[model samples]
Target: MSASAPICLERGDIQGGILRAYGKRGYPRARFLLFHVARAEAGRWFLEQLRPRVTPALDWAEGGESVKPGQMTRPEVTLNLAFTFRGLEALGVPLRTLKGFPEAFADGMAQRDAVLGDDVGPNRIRFWDPVWHGEPGRAGVHVLVMLNALIAAPDVMTARLAKVTAEVVGLAGETAGGVMLLEGHRGADPRWQELAALWGPQPDGRMGPLASEHFGFNDAIGDPVFDGQYPDGAERDKCRGQGAVDGCGNWRPLATGEFILGWPDESQEVAGAPMPLDFSRNGTFFAYRKLHQDLASWDVWIESRALMLKEVWGLASLAEARATLKAKMAGRWEDGVPLVKAPTFADWQAARARMAEMTRAEQTAFLTEFGYASDREGRMCPKTAHIRRANTRDALDPLWDAKDGKGRLGSALNNRRRILRRGLPYGGRDDPDGEHGIVLLAYCADLFRQFEFVQQQWMNHGLDFDAGNDGCPIVGAHREGARFVIASSDPAKPPFVAGGLKPFVTTRGGDYFFQPSMTALRMIGQGLVDPT
Candidate 1:
C-alpha cells in the first residue's frame, strides 16, 4: 500500500528491465501506441491474455498489495497496457490511431519538489516522469477524450467494455507505451451519458459532444457563443464599448469555430522509415467557455453611467463622457483593451493586433508604465487580471520561482503554466438588459499552479507574491459601491476609480488528467505497465 511500492513496480526495476529488453531489439519503431487503464478485474483479464506473450515483472512482496498508500487490500486489479502499431502490424494486428489523453502522467515521480508544505509525501510527489519513455508532444488527450467517448459501448456494458478493451489492448512488448487511466468519472456512468447526449460523440466512439454544455458548478459561467462576432464590426465595437447598440440593424453573433484534430500525418515517410504511431491521432481539443452576459453589457452600463457622469462633470458629448469615464476607471475601455494602443479608435482588428503585440512581459511593462507595477502594486493588473494572475510569467517570488537569484525572470514558468485562451462571446447581442457575456476556455498544464491559483489567489484574493491590493479590477467580484482603483500614468496624479462593476464569469466544473504517448499505449496493451 506504500506509495513507493507502485513506483517501484511501475518505474523502477521492472520498467528498466523491459526498456532494456526493447532496446536490445534495436528500439523498434512503433507505428501506433494504444493506452488503457482499467479496474482490477479488467487488469487481471488483460494480464492473463498477455501472460503467454509477455513476462510479468511482479515481486511477491509488492504484487499482492494495493498501489495506493494506507490500503491493506490489493487493488481489485490494476491494468496498465500499451500497444505498438508497428508491433501490432508485425503480428498481423491491424491498428489505427486511437484516442489519447492530452494531459497524461509522465514516468517521473509526482511534482513533490515543486509543491509547498509538509503535506508533500511519497504519495504526493511523483518520482517518475509520465513521459519517461517518450517526449512531450501536442495531442489533445485530456479534455478531448472526456468531452467525447473514445470507445463505443452500450450503456449497460461500458464498464465491461472498458475492462475487456484494456486487456485486449494490453500485451504489446517493450518499446510500447503504457496506458493511463484518468482518475475521475467513469465512461459508463449515467451522468456521463446525460452529458454525452447533450454534447456529441467522443472522437473514439462514445456518444457526447466534443465539449460539455452544462454549467452550474463552482464559479461556472453559462454557455457562450464559441467564437461569435456581432454584425457590422462597428456595432461590435460599440457593444464592446457601451455594452449596447441602438442604430445597428442586423447585429448578431456567430457560434463555434472550425475543429482541428491533433493527429499526426501518416502519409509522410521519415528518414526512409514509416512514421511513428500517431497516439494523439484523430483527437481534437474543444475549448468551452462560461461567459457572463451582464458583464459584457458594460458598454451600456458605461453609457448610462456616462449620462450621470456628464451631469457631474458637465460634459457635453457622449464621446467626452466616455473619455472621462475611461480616465476615471484608469484604463481606455471595458474589455481591458487600452485606448493608448488603439488611440484612433480603430476596429476590433486593430485592437486584436495591439493585444497580440503585448506579451506578458510587455503587458506588465505597459501596466507598470501607467504607474501600476505587477511586482509591487496589484492595482495595475489588480493582482488578478487573467494575465497577471495566471503564472504571472515569472513574476512570482523566489520560493515559487524556478531559478535562484534571477528573481522571477530566471524560470520557465511559461511552459508549465501557459493557458490557451480560446474565448467566445455568449448571449444575444440584441438583448438590452446586458445579459450577453463571454465564455473563456483556457487550457493549461497545471490547474493548481496555473488556473486555480490565479482564480483563488491572484484574481480572487489579490494575493500575489507581494500580497497587496484587491482582486482583478475587471473580473474581481466585490461588494456594491466598493471603489476599484488603478493608478494613472502620472505617479504624481491621483488614481482613477470605478464603482459597481459586478462579477461576470465564474468557474464551473473541471478536472485534471494526463496525456500519454501512443508508444505508451502499447506498453499498457502488453500488460507491461511496470517499466521498473
Candidate 2:
C-alpha cells in the first residue's frame, strides 16, 4: 500500500514553524532573535526559556490562533527555536544526535555558501555580509528564536510582543544564558538591542492589511499544504484545480516527511533522525536567510526594458509591455496570479475578481492548481520563468521507472527536495537602500539534498533544468551578457531574447540550524539528552 498520510506524526513535539504558514495565518508581526549560550548548561537554560511560550504544532492547532475575517482578533504568538552547530555543543547535545544530523548542517551554512560566476566549478561565497561572515566573537549568534505575532494592526503589536518576548527570559527569575543579536543597536533601547529584536512588516489597511511585501506581490501565495493538514481537515483536494499538484494526474498532498522529521519521505525512507528517535522526531533543519531585493534598479530596468520589449511583443502601450515582462520573469503577476493559468494581463482581471469571490478552498485550488506540462514549448509560460524554475513541478521527470513511468518521477523528485518556506518581508515598499528584503526560513529534513541542491543546481545553474546557462529571471545571479528568452507561440515569429540582465535578489546573510522537537527540548532542559 502507498504511504499513508499523517504517518504517526508527533505533532505535540513538532515546532509550529514546520507546519504553520505564519504569513498565511496573518502573523505579520515577527522578530527573529539570535542568542549565544553563555552558561555551561546552556541547553538546560535554553530549555527553561522554551518552556513558557514555545508553541508546539499540535498545541497551536488546538488553541494557537484567534483569527477573524482576514485579521487576527487578539494578538496570538508562535515560537520555533533552532540551534547553531556551536549552540548544540554548548547545550550538551549527545554525540549520537550530533553525529546523526547531516554534515552540511553540523558544519553550518557559513562553510558552504555557494557562489556562481557563469563558468562555475567551485565558487566562493557571493554574499559577504559582516553579520554572517564575521567570527564568533563578533557575530555571537548561537540560538535562533523565531517569534511570530498574529496581530491585526501595529498599534497593539508592540506591547503584546514585548510581553511574550520577556516571558522567555524572565522565566523563574533566570537568564536565557545568552545575549540576543539585534540587526541594529543605534537609536534603540539597550534591552531591545540585547534581545536582537529585529521586527518585520507591520500590516495596516482598510479591509484588513493587504497580504503583500515590498514588491507589491501577494506574498506567500501558495504555501504547500502537507499531509497532516488539509482543506476541511479530512477531505482530500481534487486534482483538477488546487494548490500544488503532484506529477501524477491526481492532485494529492505532499508526503508528511517532506518537512516533518522521522517520517518516510518521498523516497519511502525514514529520513535522518538523531540517536534518540524522539530527539529528532518532529524536528527539521532550518535555513534562516536574509535576502535583499533591489527595487529602484528593478523599476529602472523594467521601464527601460519594457520599451525594448514593446517591439518584441508588438504591444501598443508600455504598460502592456511592462506587465508582460514582469509576468515572464515572475511566472506570476504581482498579485500572485500565475501566468500559466492566464497567459495575458488582459485575462487576469476577471480571474482575480473570480478568485476574490471564491471560497478559501476554491481560491487555493484555483491559485495553486497549475502545471507546465501543457506549456512544454514555453508558449504560455517561458521555460526560465522564476516560479517554473523554482518549483519545476512536473517540469522535469525523475529517474524513469518501467513501472511508474515519467509523470511520477517529477513529483517524486520534487517531494524529496521540498523545503517549507516560512518567513516574512523585512522592509517597506520604498526602502531605497535600507535594511530591506526577506528573512526566509526554509525547514527541511536534509539540508544538502533539499535546500542547497535547489539553490545551486536549480536557482543558480540551469544545465540540469535544460535551459542551458539560463539563470532564474528574478533572483538568478546571471553573469555578464546574461539573457532571458521568451519563447514565441507563433511558429513564424522567432523567440525574443532579452539580454543584459542583472541579478535582482542578493543574499545578505544566513545560516543553517536544527529545530529540535519539544521532547528533545525537555531532555535538553533536564540535561538528559545523551546520544553518546
Best by lDDT: 2
What is the Cα-based lDDT of residue 490 in candidate 2?
57
Pairs with backbone N, CA or C atoms under 3 Å apart (clashes), candidate 2: 181-196, 182-196, 242-365, 242-369
Root-mean-square deviation of Cα positions for candidate 2 versus the true structure, in angstroms: 4.9
- For residue 326, model 1's alpha carbon misses the true position, in angstroms, by 7.2
Shift in Å, residue 347, candidate 1: 14
What do the candidate models score in CA lDDT, each in turn? 0.32, 0.66
Scanning candidate 2 in windows of ten residues, the lowest lDDT window is 186-195
Predicted candidate 2 versus true structure: per-residue lDDT over 1-532, tens digit per residue: 1244434455567766567776666676776665656664644665676765667665232255664332322327777788887778777777767788778887777677543231232122444345455464664557777777775557576566777777765642365434444343211332321111223444353434556656556666655656665333342553233323555555666666777788766667787677888787877888877766777767788888899878876777999888888888878887778888888767787788888788977876677777777777778788888777767777775533325544354455665666778787776544443545667888777888888877777787778657787888777776778788887655656677787876667666678888888887787778887675
Runs in model 1 deviating more than 4 A are: 1-292, 295-301, 304-417, 423-427, 430-441, 465-469, 477-482, 490-494, 520-528
Q: Per-residue CA lDDT of candidate 1, range 32-82, in tens? A: 112332233343344345433322223213445545532222212222222
Model 1 is weakest, by summed lDDT over 10 consecutive residues, at 1-10
Task: Report, for all candidates in order, the number of backbone clashes.
Answer: 87, 4
Question: What TM-score, to 2 decimals, does candidate 2 have?
Answer: 0.86
